[model samples]
Target: MAGIYLRGKTWWGRVQKDGQDLRQSLETRSESVARGRLKVWLDELEALAWGGKPRLTVNAAMDEFQKEHGPTLRPSTVRRYGVSIDHLDAFLGDKLLLTVRSSDLKDFETARRTAGASAPTVRRDLACLSTVFGFAIEKEWADINPVIPFLRQRAKRGLRESPPRTRYLTRAEEARLIESALPYVADAILFAIYTGLRQEEQFSLTWEQVDLARKHVTISAETAKGKRERTVILLAPALAVLKRIPRHLKSPFVFHHGAATTTRGARRALPSASTKKDNDGERFNHLDRGLRNAAKRAKVPLLRWHDLRRTHGCRLLQEEKWTLEMVRDQLGHRSVVQTERSYAFLEVEDRRMAAHGPGTNPGTAAAQEIDNATGEPIAAQKPAQGRRTDLEKLKKSTA
Candidate 1:
């Protein structure tokens, strides 16, 4: 049994279960409200006794989740989770896990948006919060995941999403950009174009992973984006880039760089340098700045490093006429559907070219016919051979 009594200024709740006395402040002076609060508290306690969800705060649940799962995650992922958790705690730290309704989540989303967070950033925060709630449900600290339905509703409305990028570099554009780029950047560009490796994968690659004899580099599961080991074939260009890249004795990175300033006016060394580096070595981490300067010099605007990788996939799909599954495996995509979705427009274009006979249109020859006397282009004549045969057959059948 549970009941409430009036103290001097507030109402206090008392409950007895399993020969133990439990008391708590209902934190209200109104009798009816205090009675309701006490009833809810007792219900929670009874539920807990029957192996139901226990009352937990958002902060507590997040802490437990981090403690339990943080060690298994990558450092970068752990850092990202920490950032999301910090944002989440600022809004919903004091709220009980079970009391976090969809409306409250909407409010959080609104707050993040109002604070100038982009749609993707806010979605990531909510996703992290939702993961915490899922952990709470698994632990029986929460009964329902409110964020799941809220996300579904947001998805149905299709709010605040940017257009997908489909930019790929042409051969001339690649050549001009490489000609204007620094030596190290040029190497990276070639490797990226040839191997289609992600920026992280390429930058993090070490000499140990490369097998010169086999002409392949193994991306360990820990280093891979999909958390699965993959092998990237080294084409002639990629292998040539590797052969030209000088090995650094102290550095383990395949694409290592020297210190920024050997002196005030002197530029960074090319190929490799003997400047001191940390345990991981002074690797080429910031590529965008160099790439931007090179693109500007090359008179190419809006160029990105990812465009190199995109060029690889597009060339393989469009020029080589590789199947979708082949491109998917080459690009390290877990599903062929992803490869098809990205390059499906190329396939449509290919079919159109095939139907039109390469560069010629359906009736280009007739359209190009010029009158000898007037020297003027004539109207294209429609093909009537099949139509005349069909009409003759119809007339014969009628007769």
Candidate 2:
């Protein structure tokens, strides 16, 4: 049998192939270390037997992984992995795939963090590297996934992720923002505040996916981030926004920029070859300019389009008191843990209410709470609980 065995105090690996007996010193007295080295040694021997490359470079492994897996992934995802690869290749590209160790990965992690990569970014880079190693293992070019154990050890150290952004609009700020935005942008903002749809979902939405009668929008599995179909309930405000927006005769998009009548001589003059013409009366890639102008006019600082989606989620939990599971479904999250991670802080007041008494309503019982958006005392917004029954009640109240 081709395996590792102890000879005196040292470990040795032996393999018989092509009627040639081969034996190598594992160079370690420790059984565990010897076992790992033996595996690598055996893999190299097998590669040589099959006339395959005995040593695969990190860059070669990553390139092979991308070539094999890239087509199956979304373009955006492929691009994201490419970026992570670029970062990872800078450190480990020239090294032999099997020669890398867990300590080397830890050093890379430390270097990335020291270079101002966010916790999430470093984690993503590691994930990309891990996938490459996994690919190498599958190809029999590597014997062990060094990144996996390092990730487990890293997790065990209780490394904290960067805090998620908690920015959301209050009622007053929302009203002012809507008032200040262009008609199309205003409609989009209001719809986002009630639907909590991601930017891609909202912008790419068409009338065909919307079921106004059913009071919901069907997100196709192809469009969803999780690659699963889900429904976003159309709250009263979102429904109203949809009903009032005029459908363009020729455009399939629910939210089109209509046409560009303004001249951009300054922008146009910069470079004709590099400037890509945007398709008008079609899906909007972004409403940054319009939203930026609106935020400025409304005197809202540091407002982003995503904040509107956050506003919807925050309002749902704070104003409607929906459970984490319900919010997770509404926001199209894969699990309630994701929802809770994002909006769990909204429930701090509920915890306070619990501490006080069962019947106590903090928003009404006490003075108005300070608005996170505007930093002003706002009137108490009534809260609801649960999904089906509360949803029905909301529909009636809005009606």
Candidate 3:
């Protein structure tokens, strides 16, 4: 006969045969799985137990994960995962997988927050750990994942994510910022604005991906954030920008960084190469200082790299009046929900601005002034006096 008991969401079994004692985890939270496994153990196999879910440490599991799964992910993603491993390794060093309790994870979360990690960042680290634990489960190194339950509990308690930022640059601000940027950063900035590319995607662009003859740029499947290849239609401005980019003799990078001299945190000369490096690695990132300098010089609000992408969407929807689906496809967003949630406010504000006329206060226009066809109010050259509502008009007429 064999007896099984629950321990921290897992079932452990105890059995004695031929005056020898054996105890092991039945490797499931469900009573039914425990019973079935116990019955099979008693009936079959000369050895009685599961050889005790292999005694491996968290660090060791992380190592195996890196060896197995790291190569398949993007370099930036791999780097982030590596950072997460460092955090977990320090806290859970030499801790066995089966012995890890929910309390331990909670402690890690508290310690991480106390150490100045934001809630969202800590959540990402936990997610990375959960991925590692899932890998261990697949390898049979772990039976019970502690992260799953902890996350569930935290979610129920309303541990929330910060709201997405809606920062965008106006046309004038965009021009000034580009003018103030150094040559290399300026090119990257323009590329980001025109194509709505992510920092990684734009900076990592190579000569091979650009097709000036076809009047489009190809974002390959591996390079794109959504992991799907999409074409960026090169409009007149984008084409002009592309044409103006100075061609380098040997470098395959579309936007090449030219070295001037030794500054505190500025430019390092890259070694010139003959052929294109289409390898799925991140570009050498040194845009922070230049971006700051550009913002300072332009006297504009400091815009992040992602903000340029937002600006692209803003212009298209606000000025061009492109549909949400069109913007979504152009931006290579996974779904329309993301497109709408992030950029819908731009369209709404543009409409409001149109209704009031740009010179006047927002939303202070006559309802009749709003064009029914486009849902945008016609702007008059000489800004009209703010339109009064029907009630105010009736009062004024009576008076």
Candidate 4:
């Protein structure tokens, strides 16, 4: 049996079940509404006691989930999930799992946003909370999942999402950045720009993964963020960077000492300075700061290692020789949409170039005569047959 009570202006229901108490807000002011909710809650509690499905405290489900799950995920990922769990536990307190409502989740979002949390950050926490709820459902500790419904109905994607970055380096900016950086840092920037490898892939790069003869570098599943193995085809510039990297006796890492600061003469005397690395992922993890410092010196805009990866993706996708499918695979993205979101900076660049470009529109030349500035009849300009042949030859050579 259940009892209904008027709490302030709202209704709440409480029932005794399996020697424990279940309580939740009915969220109504009317007496009839309170009694109706009490009846339904009593029915549910009776079913639960009769072995319909057990329930859990939010804390209990999270504990069991962390203990039971083992997917060989990255250490950073484990830490991130732990952080999300900590936030959820703090917010939930001793709340029961099944009583979580979509409204409660919406309240949490409003509170977090008020406290300066971005939508993406709140979304991540919700996703982790949903995972915990899913685990509870899997163990039959809860009959319903609350988070998924909330995410779908309450916070559809793009609520307060920060804009995706479109800042990729131009060739001249890249050259200036490279020249401004230290030797090892410069090599890393060049390699990342050419290979489209993420920062972790770059940090975890080892001699074992590189095959000079095969012209490829294999990123193992453990080292890659997507937990999938991928092979990056090495171009001539990448190969040149590889050949020039000085290997040392202390480490087998491909890129070491990104923060290495030594005069050329001193570096020559102590070749181990270049290889004086932990040879682990922990070392040089903060290489972005080094790049920023070099950017300050070079007078280029502050650039991240990821921007180089984007630059590579944009360049490859813009090239006439490479197919979009090929670029998507090379970027190691799960979908073309992911590739476009990150590297589609080129879309705007190309459009701007074409609109104000030096030449007449090739497609429009033979189709019809139209004014460039206004929609009016004008003399049609025809490109010569030889000029078209020259364009074909250039495309063939580039391809």
Model 4 misplacement above 4 A: 1-54, 156-160, 265-283, 340-342, 358-399
- Each model's lDDT comes to 0.75, 0.76, 0.73, 0.71
Q: Which stretches of candidate 3 lie over 4 Å from their true place?
A: 1-52, 156-158, 259-286, 347-351, 358-399
Across 253-304, the per-residue lDDT of candidate 1 in tens digits comes to 8876642221223333332332333333567764887678667766556878
Clashes of each: 0, 0, 0, 0
Better of 2 and 3 by TM-score: 3
> Candidate 2's residue-wise lDDT over 128-189, tens digit each?
89888878878877788888877777876754355678777756677667766656677788
TM-score of each: 0.70, 0.67, 0.69, 0.69
lDDT of 3: 0.73
lDDT of 4 by residue, 241-319 (tens): 9997776555667776532433332232323224333332224554786588567665556577788887787667654
Q: Which stretches of candidate 2 lie over 4 Å from their true place?
A: 1-54, 74-76, 138-141, 155-160, 259-278, 288-293, 301-304, 321-323, 352-399
lDDT of 3 by residue, 208-254 (tens): 89999998898888878888999987767778778877565666767
Question: Could you tell me which residue pairs clash in candidate 3?
Answer: none
Q: Model 3 compared with the native: what TM-score?
A: 0.69
Q: If the candidates were sorted by their lDDT against the true structure, best first, what order would they fall in? A: 2, 1, 3, 4
Give the distance in Å from residue 49's predicted Cα in candidate 2 to where it truly belongs.
Answer: 3.7
